[model samples]
Target: MKYLFGPVPSRRLGHSLGIDLIPFKTCTYDCIYCELGRTTHLKDKPAAYMSAKEIKAELDTFFANHHPPVDFITLGGSGEPTLNANLAQIVEIVKNLNKAPLAVLTNGSLLWREEIVNALLKADVVLPSLDTVFIKTWKKINRPHPLLKLETIINGLKGFRRKYKGQIWLEILFVRGVNDTEVEIEALHRVLEEISPEKIQLNTVVRPPAERGVEPLTKKDLEEIKEKLGPKAEIVVDFKRPIEERAELLNLREEIIALLSRRPCVLEDIVHALGAHINTVIKMMDGLQKENLVDAYLHNGKRYYLIRKGER
Candidate 1:
């Protein structure tokens, strides 16, 4: 369970079983709006940070359990997944398992590399983020590595689209006054047309982000952008469907603490992660707070819960 962290609910992928390939915060971009805090190991090079053997062992152990059904086995967590050198081998391992459809979530920075594109060819679906088309806004929002270029990333996406046969759900996260300008949207619309993803998911900051003052766009704002982006575009909404029961979720305190240690989550996130009722999660939070095991603070109207530092 060191790498596999959820059959957590996802708005796009339903109940996704997440696979963490890269180390925590090891990424190509240190985006201001990232919910998992800042990127600590910012690099563009792909490395064997994790071995295929280790991933295979974890997936085998996970599948051996009688767990709840998951919609997709997603290769993503903590940081950019594409940076893992054993991506193709890991993808093959998952495909061999045949438990569920495999999906790769990436920042689309490394897609310009032919090897990276080839490595992802076996995935059932790929979700890549393209926050902005403009270099200034791209840097402002994504804070990408010095080696990354907007043009290269776009070309990579376009190249991948040409070769890959699977579904591509392209994500564009809008930060108010940063990447939400009229000019950038129009440019993005043009670029998206060329890439031709099956869906264009428009997202804004909903969770507590790495930096302060990073604001989310309103529903009205997103709707207008969706209209401009045309029929393929849809806003990424919160996952509302009830989660299927997992037999092993007996210890709510441990589960909540485990999730929070990875990243601060709202009550809704805890509910989805644990597949527990909202009221149940609320009660658990209250108990944890009283026990001094967890602490919460409000950010942009959302209360985020986290494990108290140095509290085991």
Candidate 2:
């Protein structure tokens, strides 16, 4: 399962099967709050980061033995999945193998290129990252590659929206003390107004961030940010309702719990392993805590999730 992992659930994309085409954090930006840590191969353009044939072979092997089906074949993990040169080909192959929709989880860096835009045309969903709308704050928070330009990326987004006939869910992750200023929110609001995505998902560091300085935005702050972002904006999600369970999720909750049993972790680790969402995690943790299977603690100013007595 080199490329295939977890028909894991997600707050945004229900039952998801994640496809990691790029290696660890080989992205266009070194975002401050990335769960997988810093972007190691930071680049502004796309390249042959992984072999398309290899990815397809991996998927062939995965779908052969996997169960249930899937809501979406999500291009995610390690870094910006678009950085993989053969992404378009991979998506084409995936479309042939499954009835589920396909998605690309990106940093919104490469959308400026016409070729990249063409490549993603068949994808059912595109979840692009827009952490900051202002260039200064964008640079400060996302720390994009030297070759990257904010205006160019924005144009790319607009171009993609005009051409692609799929759902575009824009994500804006706020970091306390850095990109969470009132001014920054206003800038992001203006940007959202232009992009006009089907949904604007507001998020924060609910996990151990790549850097110590990065922090989560409070619920109050998130509400304000959502208001400013207008009608399309959605606060931290709550993925509780079941969606006819696509993909094989047998032992998913158990496997996630087993992982947590080893050590205390925030929502990101769970998301990393299970492909679930933070909202789903909040619900799962609450349930586990009620059953005395999990414990909650705070370290420094951040929260830590751990296994409870007898459970560990």
Candidate 3:
């Protein structure tokens, strides 16, 4: 309840239960279009960011109830999860509790470390973001740590590919005017060929992005990237999410408030948990907040929701 966020429906991961290990914004890069906004502590180091025991205890509570099933247990939430020294331990615990595949969505900065790669080997899926291929583009898009080098990151990814056994899904999040150029795409192509990921997921900024009006890549531009990346590239439309029933959808927005009374749930986590359409959930959340049924707060750049009493 404290560390686990959701059994939310993900377009990529299906029903995902999120485990946030590190403190908010404690990542190596500060992506411009990050839904969580600007990074505060832009550092990536292996440390005891959070305890494996604590995370395990949270999972124990959730599994004890065993109300619903999740498609996967995801290691991502407030910050880059790999920074937490206990990530491997957390992954093992998640696997023991829920046999569902454990997925980790990361920025891919730390893949250079063998220890990190070894830690992540048991995961079913590892979604790593490589926003740009060239160093300039990398800086423009990710704004990485002053000490982090593009070459090192690339080599690290290559090394990870050779050693890691799980399926690697490479994610490239493009901002309109930042790293969407032909040259950048070509570099990405080369990198993709080297990484040989099982999938290439193309994405864009659609949420309350860190910078407003960063602009979404036009259909034509996205098409060009898709063509350049060849058959491997697949664009994840900024919109659309997993949902089944409208009645269940409505209950999600209301139930979400009660659910978060135990832990903070993010926008994506809520959508995944309820398996409700994102737009529908957003509209209802707006109305609920207008009536003061729930509370929305930003912690270290990431927004989270919780139920507020004496309102709804």
Candidate 4:
């Protein structure tokens, strides 16, 4: 499962099975708030980062082993998925193997290209990021590659909206004092109207970010922004429902608890032992805490998750 990462929980798309198309940290923009840290490749051009055959093999193995109820087979991971040269081919292959909806998560840097837009036509949903509309704010927030122009990216999104018939859930990650300014939000609102996505998911930095300067907005601030963006917008920061059992997540939860029962472990410890994504681990930890099955305590200034004594 080199390319396939998870049937992990998601607040938007439940039980999303993630497929990593590009190599680790390879992307067009080195976003300030990326949880995966800085962009290592900083690539703009599309090339075959991973072979279609390899991805197809993984998909086959995954479905054969566990035909878990997956909401979406998301094409995204450590980097911009569009950069994978054989994106359309991979999508076609996956679609042949599964009935679940297909999705693509991208930074929207390459959407302006006609080829990229056409390639994504088969996706059931496309979630592209839009942090800011202004060039200065875009530069400051995304730190895009030199070849990626702000205007080009905006126009590309607009163009893609016009051409794409699938659901577009445009995401805007605002940092306090960065893109949350009055003028910035106003401009973004106007552009968002032009894009006219099915939904506008507002998000901010939550977990530890790549850069310390990146700050998250409070729920109060997020509510205000959602109001400004109109009825189509909603905050996607938190989840109220429990993770579905259909996601085949019981095993993951059991595994985490077993490791914690032996000894308390940090997020990294669970991830390393299980070879799971950090985001997935965080969500699992949140669910475990909500159920009072696990708790965290600071040890040597680092928080570690542990099984509750009563349960133990």
TM per candidate: 0.79, 0.75, 0.77, 0.79
Give the local distance difference test score of model 1. Answer: 0.87
lDDT of each: 0.87, 0.78, 0.80, 0.87
Most accurate candidate by lDDT: 1
**What TM-score would candidate 3 get against the native?**
0.77
Off by over 4 Å in 4: 239-273, 277-312
Better of 1 and 2 by lDDT: 1
C-alpha RMSD of each candidate structure in angstroms: 8.4, 9.2, 6.6, 7.8
In candidate 4, position 209 carries an lDDT of 74
Q: Deviation in angstroms for 93 in model 4?
A: 1.1
lDDT per residue (tens digit) for residues 153-258 in model 1: 9999999999999999999999999999899899999999999999999998876678999998988999999999999999994422212222233366678888
Clashes found in each candidate (C-alpha, N, C closer than 3 A) = 0, 2, 3, 0
**Best-to-worst lDDT order:** 1, 4, 3, 2
